[model samples]
Target: MKSNTPRMPGRPKRQDQDMPVQETVLFTASRLFMELGYEAVSLQQIAKACGVTKASIYYYFDGKPQLFTASVSAVLERARTSTSQILVQPLPLRERLIKVSEAKLARSHGDFETILREARSSLSQKQLDEITSKEEMIHDCLAEHLIKAMDAGEIRRTDPLLTAHAFSAVLMLGIREIAKGTPADKLARDIVDLFWDGLSIR
Candidate 1:
């Protein structure tokens, strides 16, 4: 989930000394973690991928668990912030929802979920709780947006909370598969069709 690019406000400023290097390492490590589960990857592998010595990586992170946690947290927090901003934008409900969806999927950045999955066993209870809280907030944010759309009759009158979670689940599933491919435009079109028209033989 660690992103190479910054996209939100009020984030901790990165220093010139070693932060960028750490970020670069973390970003690359996140992609590897996503494609290969945590249990399957080694610290030496990550260090090699970063083109740095294992000792150099140790300068920034204590170990794999800490590095993995920090990397995923950075990515997830950014994604949440970006998604929140898009979902709460002052636009038409349908447009806002679509924008929010696009932003969320884009924020996935092709490897966020994979890193998240691989980092599961490395997190402490506190880290797990923090992650869960952020995820729940994201879901709630989407539900609130959906409620607005429902009130405006911009979409069907489904239960906002349920609909939001359902939409997110479906979207993420598609995203996971599409991430391995290079067909973004088609993925977007199919998502829109599924959301607007559903799979009914009308």
Candidate 2:
């Protein structure tokens, strides 16, 4: 005779005890969600990529909308942390901005804004707010650095927040046009130079 007991959602049946299963699921989902649009990516695909069952994902996330919000938040937080590090390094503003652009260009991802626009109706106000907050933090990080640059006479005085938005928008456009085999640094320099000419004191 076998015992019939319902399993708890908190403790998932571990396939690999050593692995951080929840983080793994989130990372895999983030990659798929960013590469493919919200509507295109299914929870099953994320679970398959993570080597876990579909039910395992549900244990961690309420549903696809919840998962999408969490996945995008994770991606934005990672980018924010990394970009913060790059901006804080003891480098010229030009070099720092170039490095930032290079970092953005290095990754292969779809236009997240386009994906968000398509998925807007599907996401809840709270979920959208959460994603928007993380994104604003990234922009704010860059804006802080730009403010320092403005004070130091590196770039002309302007709205740091607006400039931050402009730089990100330009990079988003660059991502689509960047040819394979084009050196990241070269493209980065071009972008920085284009802005430097416009933003610098003339």
Which candidate tops lDDT? 2
Worst 10 residues of 1 by lDDT: 7-16
lDDT of 2 by residue, 23-89 (tens): 8888888898888888899988888888888888888888999989998999999999989999999
How far is 200's C-alpha from truth in model 1 (Å)?
14
Flag regions of model 1 displaced more than 4 Å. 1-19, 103-119, 179-182, 197-202
Candidate 2, residue 190: Cα displacement in angstroms equals 1.3
Residue 23 error, candidate 2, Å: 0.7
- Candidates' TM-scores? 0.68, 0.92
Q: Give per-residue lDDT, candidate 2, residue 43.
A: 87
Supply the TM-score for candidate 2. 0.92
Tell me which residue pairs clash in candidate 1: 1-75, 34-114
